[model samples]
Target: MRRYPEIGKFTLKVYYEKDPEVRADIQKSIAKYADFKQNVKQLNFDSSQFVPGIDIEMMYNDMYWASEGYIWEKIQDEKYDVDMMERDFLKMVDFWKSIYLRKEGEHDEGN
Candidate 1:
């Protein structure tokens, strides 16, 4: 809650791949979502509320890695997983994104 630090300031310290192409893409995302990410990070919510009792920073970083792991996955598509079980901010974000997409689809159908 109010006692917790902002999520962005949590310093997930996610690392970018050394490959130029991958690094570039990640950078682009980082830039495009800088404000969004920063704002999310700044929210004074307890990381524990969503994520498990594990190290919050590790879990947050894991979410970022998993979400952006398309390169290692040979995905050539979207990225998104990781080793943590407890729900985290990214999980909530993904959940919300799903809702938004679902609603959008519904609206399209309605139209």
Candidate 2:
């Protein structure tokens, strides 16, 4: 079996509505968990790993757009709503973190 590189960084894309308000929410939520600005060095999408019901294409597009500037800039941009975007972003971050943690080491039965 091939070993994947340790997930040193991650980027999350939320594919819900294009509305700025909703996007903001998602961004805020993500910030609460993952430091989108600090933790995520780059944002890209893999269709094979994307969650069901989420539009991976749209998320990828948003990430590409946000990549132009730092996390704060992306959140402040009128293109998306920080609060709503945070929610989805955070969830995605959490999921990614979980996978990263799992791959790093197996949980000890007694810890």
Candidate 3:
């Protein structure tokens, strides 16, 4: 995670990993971040101040591209099962929301 003051931007970059599981986790995190940012936007919140929306970008190596049995690879295909990805993203978002609510001393009813 990195924040640039000059540009008033936040970004998260994940380096390519040899382990398929790790890569998948990184992808899930990115998805969660995107969902959380969108939810924030929908709430009419100022992301540039309250959240300062993050740009999540991923890097993949040749090894990942060559994989035939990896879940990440399956996710890239249009016909693949996407429930796993959605579940992971939602789970991550829930966990983060819990933490944020705790920090802010707010109830998690609507969140």
Candidate 4:
């Protein structure tokens, strides 16, 4: 981020850390970019590298990063029924296709 100093890191961690053995075994897999950069590789998740979709202005209209309602938990909370989920799945496909990297001969498409 250009202003990481102003906005501290908001890391989204989604994994298990049960015990010391797990920590030792999965340290490499779970390591964040910052920790890896500090200890192993000097790489960063620079904000400039991420090119958001043109439709990002209406990003709220879609749920490409909706991790909540899709996961299995102690209590079930499915936001979409089977048919609705099917339709949303198609929309999700279209959304990804709209912004995916275009090939050499490909022209601009919807985003």
Clashing residue pairs for model 3:
47-52
TM-score of each: 0.31, 0.25, 0.27, 0.28
Off by over 4 Å in 2: 1-79, 103-111
- Mind giving the per-residue lDDT tens digits that candidate 4 earns over 1-111? 234422211221223344677566566675552142353234333322224344432332334234224323311432324455557667766765565434345443462
lDDT string for model 1 (14-78, tens) is: 33356786678677777744344565667666543442234544545555565555324522322
What TM-score would candidate 3 get against the native? 0.27
lDDT, candidate 1, residue 59? 49
Compute the lDDT for candidate 3. 0.41
Distance from true location, Cα of 51 in model 2, Å: 20
lDDT of 3 by residue, 1-111 (tens): 113322311111133345787788877765643453454455564333222223321111222233323544543453543466557557755654453323444343555
RMSD of each: 16.7, 16.4, 15.8, 14.4
TM-score of 4: 0.28
Off by over 4 Å in 1: 1-41, 48-53, 71-111
Task: Write the candidate numbers in order of decreasing lDDT.
Answer: 2, 1, 3, 4
Indicate which candidate wins on lDDT: 2
Error of 1 at 73 (Å): 4.4
lDDT per residue, candidate 2, 71-111, as tens digits? 44554443554456567667766765454333444444555
**Local distance difference test values of all predictions, in order:** 0.45, 0.47, 0.41, 0.40
